[model samples]
Target: MSIWWSLHLRREAASVPLARRLLLGTMETAGVDPDVSYDLSVALGEACANAVEHGGGASRGGSSEAYRVTAYLDGEKCRIEVADSGPGFARAHAPRPPRVDAEHGRGLFLIRELADHVHIGDKPGRGGTVVSFDKMLKWTKDPSLLTA
Candidate 1:
């Protein structure tokens, strides 16, 4: 059996901390590796930031939007999905190759680089995008559970 949790977060930068807390708490209880948790946190943070930035319409005064985040964890992997309300990203827009001096776009880029698998889904119902990514985890066993 796999463990899965989903959260609906407002489309605001302030929600980043909330998202982090949820991710940390979920992964920690699952016995995920420390390094993997850190990486996934960073990746999930970036994905959330992008959702807020783009969902807010940046300078277009669109503040009625929201986003959703879902995380699934199994014995060997942790997968997360970030969704937004409107102005979602296109599915085919692959993350650009890293550059030494570029400074404009790179949120999804980092998510792709760090996650073992990444999936971008079209907005459901209305308009928005859901970017999903997963990271592999090292397997560990607890003797207590076997004896329980």
Candidate 2:
């Protein structure tokens, strides 16, 4: 079975957990392994938080008041994408690892560590960042719903 959903959320702190909860609930209902679900939820939260923080400013060319989160569960794999409307990654380089003593700049790195594959880039024909990641799903011993 396959499932997908998308949310256009305000760029606010509260929206982070709301997106995380929905992803968690969906994974739980689909009988995903709890550990896997937790990892994905954490990654989702980080992505959402990043969008809320860096997703808005002087509009480069897109909507500045909201961002988007999309999730896809297909067979043995699950993918998630978080997109925002802010100045794109004009830095022209990958995110550098944060310092151990630093309090920030770890979100992208955390997502890369948790997910099997990650893509961070500018949205096509737009001024924003798009962070996409996917992981191999693990099912519970006895799946209650969708199973691979």
Candidate 3:
């Protein structure tokens, strides 16, 4: 079976963990290995945090600013995308290694390391950012019907 969900959340600190938890629950229910789930959850947290922090600077007057998180689980692969409607940075400027004592600037790096594939791009005309990633799912108990 394939599972998918999308959440349109306010650009706030609380939204980050909410997205992560929802992912965790879905993974757990799907019998994904704990270690794999943990890795993906951390990566999701980083992406969501980035969205909350830098994805909502271009809101028009009176419009409620928000970000979107979408996740898809199909067979042995899971794909996730987080998008925000804010002025975003360019992908050509790759994430740099931060100083050892730095308090921040590690989100994209973590996402790239944890996920099997990561892509960053502009969200079309609105000039927002989108962080999309996918990981090969490992299940402790494989379901016989899932061929892919």
> Using lDDT as the measure, which candidate wins?
2
Compute each candidate's TM-score over C-alphas.
Answer: 0.80, 0.92, 0.89
* Alpha-carbon deviation at 51 in model 1, angstroms: 0.5
Worst-scoring 10-residue span by lDDT in model 2? 139-148
lDDT of 3 by residue, 76-105 (tens): 899999998877877677668978888999
Model 1: worst 10 consecutive residues (lDDT sum): 139-148
lDDT of each: 0.76, 0.90, 0.87
Model 2 stretches with alpha carbons more than 4 Å out: 60-62, 91-93, 146-148
Q: Model 3, which residues run further than 4 Å from truth?
A: 61-64, 142-148
Candidate closer to the true structure by TM-score (higher is better), 1 or 3: 3
Query: Residue 101 of candidate 3: its Cα lDDT?
Result: 85
lDDT of 1 by residue, 24-97 (tens): 77666666666788889999999899888876543233433667788888767788988877666765775567
User: By lDDT, is 1 or 2 better?
Assistant: 2
Model 1: lDDT of residue 92: 71
- For candidate 3, what is the TM-score? 0.89
* Positional deviation of residue 86's Cα in model 2 after best superposition, in angstroms: 0.8
